[model samples]
Target: MLGADFYMPTRVFFGENALQRGKEMLLKAGHHAFIVTGKSSAKKCGALDEVTTLLQEGGIPFTVFDGVTENPPLLTCFEAGAKAAACGADFVIGIGGGSPLDAAKAIAAFAANQGMAPMDIYDDAKRLCPTLPLFAIPTTAGTGSEVNPYSVLTLEGGMKKKTFKAPDSWPRAAFVDPRYAYTLPHGATVSCALDAFAHALESYLSPKSTVFSQTAAVFAAREIWDVLSAMPGEFDVEMRTRLALAATVAGMAISVTGTGFPHPLGYSLTLLDGVPHGRACAAFAADYITYNEKSDEGRALIAAFAAAIGTKPNVMKAFLPGVAEVDFSFTEAEIAERIELVAGAGNYQNSPYVISKEEMYAIYRAHFLKK
Candidate 1:
């Protein structure tokens, strides 16, 4: 049995009306709220209205910063942070998908510290300053950003994605109402669900996996796999709820064990090809599984995970392309450059098996290089 050292502080509220039910707890995060979100999703899903109404009822003053973009640039976070500070936001509420949720965490850091440069947020030393209290209201079923401390931001100068996490970056509470995800289009639904799948898969295969994290990973992976396997033409409330719970559980798994190579390996695709974050990470899932299968312990782990999900590894591998957009082609030069860019990421070290650059290149070539 693997030793456990789990520490998830985020109080997760799941089900149909989680936001409404958790309103009293949510209001306790702070006196003034900085609500960070994208322009449309939150409003469309009625989450923004719900949150604002709650604030009004609580007599809490709030500011809305609706500029978080996909991949959430560092500059945008800083700008939002400045606005949050100016408004005297004592706590932060992140709405929408992963981008806004991640941006909210960075904004909280910046707002609390005030005057720190954009890049300074990534510095480990800067973690000495406490971030403002954060509450997450996810509008989608993927990314599970509400439960994790990690905030992936697009750094300056190259559009590269980098992640930073501090102890206080975890949201104080997460209102994971699945009703908000019902408005998601088919493509967005697929992308987000696949991202959750990747998170669970990678966390299960990570060398850092503890018994607790592995259990969570298995549960999450199975739930997501069952939902995706059904391939619902339109996700009803039930489907959305399952995915939302799975994504949140997967987030918890990664929060403990971190992730394996697929996450970092997928980043170049997101930056260079504009692939959605989840689809990008999942594009490499098959290759990641195959690489890990080379080791005895890895093979055993994969078998266990496969058993938990009630499917064979090859079956899962073959099913990925149907649910994930994985056929994007790249040139040989581009593939080589992409490999070199992510080769140094610490994520690779977390893999169950040591991955070599040659193996990484081979995987890239097989999936993406133009023939």
Candidate 2:
């Protein structure tokens, strides 16, 4: 009894010269655009230039806000929103990786609802305004922030990350030009790919997963595995394109099923230990698979995933360690504290089986506790 429930409204333009090919769709977002991005990736990747050229050619005015940082803060979104509103921007364009893309969603929300408090973005029940139309141009093959409605932001004065999700937050269009990622550094490329892999793996294993999402997840996971297994070699344009598509597919999968334990469990490592988001999430991937293997259905699912990626389950688990390098150690108390922080995460409920605090502590101990 295969069933599916999928909803993806963003029009995606993927492959070489995607931005140029999709320029007409991009221009339809709004006449006045508020471009949101981090400090450098957009310019380095040439996405900014291409977007500006397109906007200029279309006679659409735009304002660029390049202040977004890694694990973007709530205050940053609020500030950028104020700037966008001040400029009378009618739409928002997000350029760069997940950070800027996520920030753009918040900026759109804030810009649309002037004077809304920073925390108000998280409270959908209290929100009374619609978000500005959003367009995404991804400079990296990670986060797939271009397609999803989730905007993960750091709380003020804290390392904790929270997601702001609304139906209106989805980008109206996504330009996924693989050429934009050609300038990405080697480490970033690997990290981004790993993040996509985690998304697919988690989504496939989620209890909420449907036939549609599982099919997407398996395809994305297979594509990512192919790219990752060929690492330490040249990532030519073809390889980048495959990875980019995989990331986008993974994002679409998670949009339906949401992520499992790895995402929430990885947040502390990313924020506190300075591990890259993708690598941090992947650090727990093997263990997450193992944890689920405790159940019969879970074992079947893992086998299915392994078969889809053309590898044995154990072999796939072994391959993760080479890429997800988490060297830091934590005291038993610290491990317990970290587990406590994420114990209440909604992702746990999405898991195939109940995840007790004790089980979480054990997983943390296996990875982070001092021997």
Per-residue CA lDDT of candidate 2, range 1-371, in tens? Answer: 54577899999998889888888877777779999989898998899999999999999999999999999999999989999999999999999999999999999999988878899888876678899999998999979888889999999876678899999999998999999999998889999999999999888888888898999999998998988887766688888999999999999999998888888889888877788989988888888888889889789899998998998888878787668877778998888777776778888877666688888888888877898
What are the clash counts of all predictions, listed in order? 0, 0
lDDT of 1 at 215: 94
lDDT of 1 by residue, 250-339 (tens): 999999888888888888888877788788888778788888899998989989999999999898777875566667678899888888
Candidate 2, residue 84: CA error in Å?
Answer: 0.9
TM-score of each: 0.97, 0.97
Q: Give the distance in Å from residue 239's predicted Cα in candidate 1 to where it truly belongs.
A: 1.1
User: Candidate 2 — what's its lDDT?
Assistant: 0.88
C-alpha-based local distance difference test score of model 1: 0.88
**Residue pairs in steric clash, candidate 2?**
none
Error of 1 at 270 (Å): 1.0
Please state every model's RMSD to the true fold in angstroms. 1.2, 1.2
* Shift of residue 207 alpha carbon in model 2, Å: 1.3
